[model samples]
Target: EFLRNELEDSTPVIIMSTAGNESNVLNAFEMGAGDFVSKPVSPSELLVRVGKLLRQRAN
Candidate 1:
């Protein structure tokens, strides 16, 4: 898998998708995504999530 092979462990993957279903969101989490944002995404919300992830990584 790309996450296992290509991505560094510290890198947080946030999936922004329009599907917004529980199954898809669960799949992303199972595959190592740090956070999931459903589409029609607000830029500010995305930024906040990104900031949270970054802060987590920093810690």
Candidate 2:
């Protein structure tokens, strides 16, 4: 999060973690995360998320 703030760049950050608590997910977004996925992540889902964010970024 500190790095995200410091970099001042538009690159997306997607957090994948085993901790699926609502607070953690919300906090990540509050800190500028583009997306979050609880673990045992699916490759297909991850790809979809990346595609979505990328499409938004393109705009």
Candidate 3:
């Protein structure tokens, strides 16, 4: 996968698909994604996920 090769370390990626499809999310994960967000996403949800990922990286 490109991400697996491109990313130097554990990088977090947030994906927004048209619908809440598991395939896209799974593929991202398989490609070394730290997180995946499906579409119809809320602002609050995005904020939370971003915050969580940042916090996780900080720790």
Number of the top TM-score candidate: 2
Question: Worst 10-residue stretch by lDDT in candidate 2?
Answer: 1-10
Instruction: Sort the candidates on TM-score, descending order.
Output: 2, 1, 3
Candidate 1 Cα misplacement greater than 4 A, ranges:
5-8
Q: Per-candidate TM vs. native?
A: 0.86, 0.91, 0.76
Each prediction's whole-model lDDT (CA): 0.87, 0.90, 0.79
- Inter-residue clash pairs, candidate 1: none
Task: Provide the clashing-pair count of each candidate structure.
Answer: 0, 0, 0
Per-residue alpha-carbon lDDT of model 3 for 1-59, expressed as tens digits? 56668666666777777765777778877877777877788999999999998999899
Off by over 4 Å in 2: none
Q: List per-candidate RMSD values in Å.
A: 1.6, 0.9, 1.9
lDDT of 1 by residue, 1-59 (tens): 38756764648889989998999999888888899998889999999999999999899
lDDT for model 2, on a 0 to 1 scale? 0.90
| Pairs that clash in candidate 3 | none
Report lDDT (Cα) of residue 18, candidate 1: 92
Which is superior by lDDT, 1 or 3? 1
